[model samples]
Target: MEFGNDCKLIVGVDYGTTSTGVSYALTGSSQCNEVISIQKWPPNCPGLKVPSLVACAGSPGRSLWGFEVRPGMKSFAWTKLLLDPTFNCDSFKVEIREVAGALGILKLPEDRDAEEVVTEFLRHVHQHVCGELKRFLFDTMSPGRVPIEFWMTFPATWSEAVQSKLKRAASEAGFGDKVFTVSEPEAAALAVFRISKDFELNVGDGVLICDCGGGTVDVTSCFITDMNERGVPYFEQLTEETGSNCGGINVDCNLYRLLVTKLGEDFKNLSTTMVGPGSNFMKEFEYIKRDFNGELPYTLTLLGPVPREITLSPGDLRGIFDPVLDRILSLILSQIKRLMQSLERVLSTSKIIFVDGFAGSPYLQIQLKSALRQQMAEVGVLVAPTPERMVACGATVKGLQGIVAQHTNAVDIMA
Candidate 1:
């Protein structure tokens, strides 16, 4: 547990609409190939990430965030989307209305805006990450003494304005003077290529990455150019990255709509009886959605006034999932088509890599695999291991590369 004088720490934060993840690497002269994900989080949330949620009812300095914001608490979620100016447009009316309604019900402080909420949330995340780093590095070295670099991942299609807003928020949250940004799809590609042993890529091989997350689905095509002396692969973009707001949240919204339709008159009791942050119904539906695979019926028991049990049959789940799944598949297919046109040849050895939280859905994997098999029998689709942590881990890898390159250049200069 020793380090050289040139040792540095790299932290990567993946702040999603629904959750956030952190990964870091400690590097020196040798190549740092291993990125450690911060699995332990506040309030004992047992996962690689914590919900991107914040409760601002109390003082701003004492605001509760992540797992600390529990059910029934008046909290803010999806504030990340508000950073985008286009989020208010007709295309995002559904999501925009959802957020507006939640804010209205919560009656958040008039002075606190989306940027402020996001900054506060990230501040908590930064503090927790620092504590974890200090504990992990214990007596070996002081994190404060090392040159720590912070890298954050953003959607590939986010506008420059949105990116700037995110960077500003991160900086205010103590991510340092200069917070680096990595496109989500590129980060996913980096992690998948670095860690995945399921498939090997040769020079000139194409990889299409489909990142299905809580707020957005992004697709990117990368061509493997070469491998470095240390066995790290290099990639070149084959086509423009494509993405849309059609993601897992859309399915949740669909379920909400279905519940409202089914419950009819009784849906009005959800406010006083059910919990905030989209109600207990949505929370229960999340587990059902993740475990669903188009074969069994999932039953949800409502606890509000006039309690009732609702059964979601296979067909009902399909109806809720198909629209969003179709949109994601279209994105992947479009990327494939564009990649083929750019290469002007067949994609015989190419593979499709799925990453991000939504990629863990069994139904999504089954449908994507089935569709790809039908269209391109030779092409293979594989889910990146620990799909949820890919972006954050990949961001760490990118940071590690930067540190190594700088160390190598300094050595050459000294020589």
Candidate 2:
């Protein structure tokens, strides 16, 4: 009897709130080092941070998907928002066809199933990626090469049941039959270990990674060490943590709100508070907060029944955003407290490493550094890179791991 040789093609996808990134690794590559940018600015999609926003359109037989959604203050029902209690999914049905409820699909009919909405979204993303892979491979190989397998990643805390649902959605969307699942943290760890292999990490050395993305706060504490003294890194999970749906997106929301309120002060008798699509005032305020850079005399325009505009100085924006800033600060401090408590119980050390999108903000980074310095004086807290592309980059590393592991196994069996 003869068996087909094992083959490998790994794809690392980061399904973020605002955007989604997909990267692939060949069988023998040292790393999945390339960053694939799916969405860019101008005519921005509904998704903000990245391009995970799925716009459902086209005929009944076939549908279209992409970063084609119009920008501005339009409301978007992100799939991640489903986990938020503020959203009412009780009236919704989760149909398997689209991966989201019919009621929530951007422009679809109102009665669609939730599952259809989600599945359709996932299917589109998969198709887009496959197209990219085809183009990438065309340049590297002849047309007759066998297709590559994919390694789809999910959050570490996702239940197997939820994961099964995602896999089913992908399969239904025509993702090749050969696909696998992985956790986001594991991928992130792989990426960190790959870059810092020379750190001489030991069981006693704790590495804390914080993924401050658009919609969620994902934190992990790991005991990174060379399980085999030969320098191959192994990770031991320590206390992992998250926060109450806090992140850069939330900060944007707060900035938008403040800006709206500041503009309203110009109106008389008639109230000038924002009242559309959640807290309008808060959303505008959040945007202004994010845009504040000590620059003077910035103008903000409000679109509503009575359109209005207001000019603001750096001081004016800061004063209006103070409340929101305080809230975020408190939230960050709380998360740190939780991490410290968890560390005390899980390991004998307290060192923490912070990485993610928020790490890029000078204001946020400075505030965090100062707070951590004051609270966890003995514990080292450091943020790598300002933009916090670690998760996407790390996911790529994991994709490479998937490739290497397969090649190693095949070689062992052949010998």
Find the candidate with the highest lDDT and give its number: 1
Candidate 2 residue 50 Cα shift, in angstroms, is 4.1
lDDT of each: 0.78, 0.51
Error of 1 at 132 (Å): 0.4
Indicate the worst ten consecutive residues by lDDT in candidate 1: 406-415
TM-score of each: 0.90, 0.68
For candidate 2, the TM-score is 0.68
Instruction: Give me the runs in candidate 1 sitting further than 4 Å from their true place.
Output: 29-31, 95-109, 139-144, 228-231, 272-280, 344-349, 403-415
